[model samples]
Target chain A: MMTLKKIAVPVAALILFGLFWEFLVWVNGWPNYKMASPSDLWPAFWKFRWLFLDYGWDTLWRTVAGLLIAVVVGVLLGMVMGFSRTMRDALYPLLVGFNAIPKATVVPIIALMFVGQHDMNTILIAFLISFFPIAVSVSIGLSTLEPEYRDILAALGASKLTIFWKIALPKTLPEFFGALKVAVTLAFIGTNLMEIVEPHGRGLGHLFDSGKISADYPLMFAVLIALAVMGILLYYIVVALEHVFAGWAERTPQ
Target chain B: MTDLIDIKGVRHAYKTASGPLPVLDGLDVAVPEGGFAAVVGPSGCGKSTLTRLIAGLMMPDAGEVLLQGKPVTGPRATVGMAFQNPVLLEWRTILQNVMLPLEIVPTKMSKAQQEERARSLLALVGLEGFEDKRPSELSGGMRQRASLCRAIVHKPEVLILDEPFGALDAFTREDLWQTMHRVKAEEPFTGVLITHDLRESIFLADQVVVLSGRPARTQYVMDIPGKGPRDLEELYTPEAAERLNILRQQIRIAQGRAAA
Candidate 1:
């Protein structure tokens, strides 16, 4: 019953939002080219459903693959930076400089360097954009760990590796999940940026670009709705994982 | 019995931007095997630094700390510690927290045996049913109990408690003191308790070592004169009162508020 209410509330709000958008468009008497109503989206989706599915799958896979690579590389780098003060000092400025560069600007450069390899460029951009949050969150989580916890393990003659496995990793899970949630959204933005910038005739971003070129505004809106739904789906997946792994961190009603 | 923990002429200072700030100055303390010594002083008297030195978590600059006659050059598995914060891992259940040291220290017990040991200690501390509960679910006093179990679960030769009960309410603190006695009866390790509570020092330790003000050194030692089970009522008795009085005066002297 509780779970049902939890799912039902946001879903009802979404329906209300759709109705509001439809009402605004109708009141203004805007042409579909100016602003597509919710009513126009269904037909556009039905007409191009197969293509949307194919393109959506391509985009989804790229985001997922990039995020997976980010998790592996980000965690290792974060651990190194978190464990050693010298390494953190050395790497932090570089990481901040890289992250500060707008990922949108990097897409053209990536296109220039790896010309015509659209999928890899999208994946690379996604990985680069997403990994920074994960690394920063993990390092902050590790460095701020309570000293007494380390003292307890150290007094036991536990090795640094053992302390990481037994304490640091579990302690950092909540923060890591927070970063993963942020990284997932960033990953999607990265993937879409590459597809829109290069327009290699693949992924949902490419489909959206095609819609814009043909003046199919409703189709473009439908593709956008598709992207939002995908982002929401991945976000919930991460939330579910957080519940499974770091549920203790969040206080539940007794 | 020989001393299980020995600190002789230990001096340490923390180097700051201004200069070297001394903490422990030529401190000396010892606790015989299975003995409990409570050290009390003014707040910043380096009592905690002494605990760390005894646990081998840090080294003193000028003197040596020994455990079982061996110089403590680095951290050793034979020393266990509990702090005022009761810093139990939130990710672990009460039972897993107790079993942490065993996982780190070299041990011959199989997994089942380790679980059994932790379960027994939890029961001893009146936390039997709370074995599977996460650290956050328990109250502060209960979490401190779990922390105590974790410290001694490895059966270390020395247990250094740096004000483990300092944060608890009076009732809870007294209850835990009783629990401490019960645990010591069964587990039997040398203990150094650094606390400000005079009654707690009297109730828990065989000897109370008083350190002088900052740049603390051992200035006085008072041995409680009985060797059997003690009642909390004894704390109000004339004999215990005299001991408490002497210790209070010693603390005053240590703080530079009274004549020596």
Candidate 2:
């Protein structure tokens, strides 16, 4: 299990980075308000573990709900666009225009429109951020199938629905999971950003903002570490699912 | 003999930027029921295009393709096809891939019956043990065999193959040729194969039709005479060699025309 080949340098570099952070805190005699050492942040995390967990759970649920909606809607629309050239030509420009809009800039406006409801604002933000990649990736993946496959399906006298279900869906699974991986990370980011602008009753983004205002550097560092862990956990969930469904995507052609 | 599939003075051309570039120039061919026919020509000679026409994937600009005395307006399940590349659905198991046509076609059989038919077809193609394996998990030759199973699962009146074994290694290709011969002998469906391999055409086809290059035309059609379905031993025979030489000469002429 210990594959040491080529990983030593990166591991060493990470260790060096930890030492540099510790060295910077010690040498500069930085005020606790400005920077928290590992010792301070560790204890702060333990003290507020339950509060952090509640906020993390709220944020996590909002992200997942919004992402699920986005994925369902995006993939359906993308399939329509992929199957019909006229629809693609008609809708793709609008999609491109929408994607170009700064989603974060509109977060406050969306919060106002939704009447400052925490769940609604967070969902809208996540939905906006997560939908584009799924749509684009699904369309591209569906359209890029080999021509010979199309000919085979046609020769079989396969109905349009049969072709879509049997060929297009399975062929697009790897790309769909790939796009989901990207979309999930974006969903997390969008949720947190929304919480910052429109602070919910309880959430990690609200916690981070509060730490900033109160000069709670140790608490802030703990929240930052928690955010990193959350992102990794979410990403790995999608990665694991990808492995289960489209494991052949990873195999190099022999 | 009545033709199961007929191509009558089929003139096909594509509208290019320069103008209409002709592919098939007034080509006429016919496959009687239970006939094994091969179309052999040089590469780029539109042999595959002719197969496409017969399969109803594309329509000729002039004339018509008839299946069972009916003009082919679009694809029909009664006509099955295989390509050089075994275009199996990567996600489905071999059994599921073979079951595809049954699911698509409007059939009276129950799901269990459909599945049984698919299994039998797979077994017929010498893929008895590969029912659960995905197309990606199978070897190239194995995938082609699965493709054959899928093609014939619906029990089509005519099976069209466009160099289905061209991508395999030599050993695998030869082995598949025998497998194909055995399958044909057992089922007795009309087969139309488009291949560049002269020996493959002679070994598998009851009659081989040689095409002229580019704007392809049926230049020659030779009957393959033997007592039964051809085997590898037939390739070494003087009769097979004479037929192969004649086909080779036709291909050389086709290539010369294409170059010109």
TM-score of each: 0.97, 0.89
Who wins the TM-score comparison? 1
What tens-digit string does per-residue lDDT give for candidate 1 at A132-230? 999999999999998898999998888888888888999999999999999999999999999988856499999999998999999999999999999
For model 1, what is the alpha-carbon lDDT of residue A2? 92
Tens-digit per-residue lDDT, B1-260, candidate 1: 55778888999998999999999997889888878999999998898888888877788899989888889988989888999999898888899989989988989999999999999999999998999999888999999999999999889888999999999999999999999988988888889999999999999999999999999999999998776457899899999998988999999999999765
- In the range B146-232, model 2's lDDT, one tens digit per residue, is 999888887889899999999889999999999898888777789899887888988998889988878988888898766356769
Most DockQ-accurate candidate: 1
At residue B61, candidate 1 shows an lDDT of: 92
lDDT per model vs. reference:
0.92, 0.85
- Model 2 alpha-carbon drift over 4 Å, by segment: A1-30, A46-50, A89-102, A112-115, A199-202, A247-254, B106-117, B257-260
Poorly placed runs, candidate 1 (over 4 Å): none
By lDDT, the best candidate is 1
Please compute DockQ, using alpha carbons, for every candidate against the native two-chain complex: 0.88, 0.63
Which ten-residue region of model 1 chain A has the weakest summed lDDT? Answer: A193-202
Q: What docking grade applies to model 1?
A: high
Q: How many backbone clashes does candidate 2 have?
A: 0
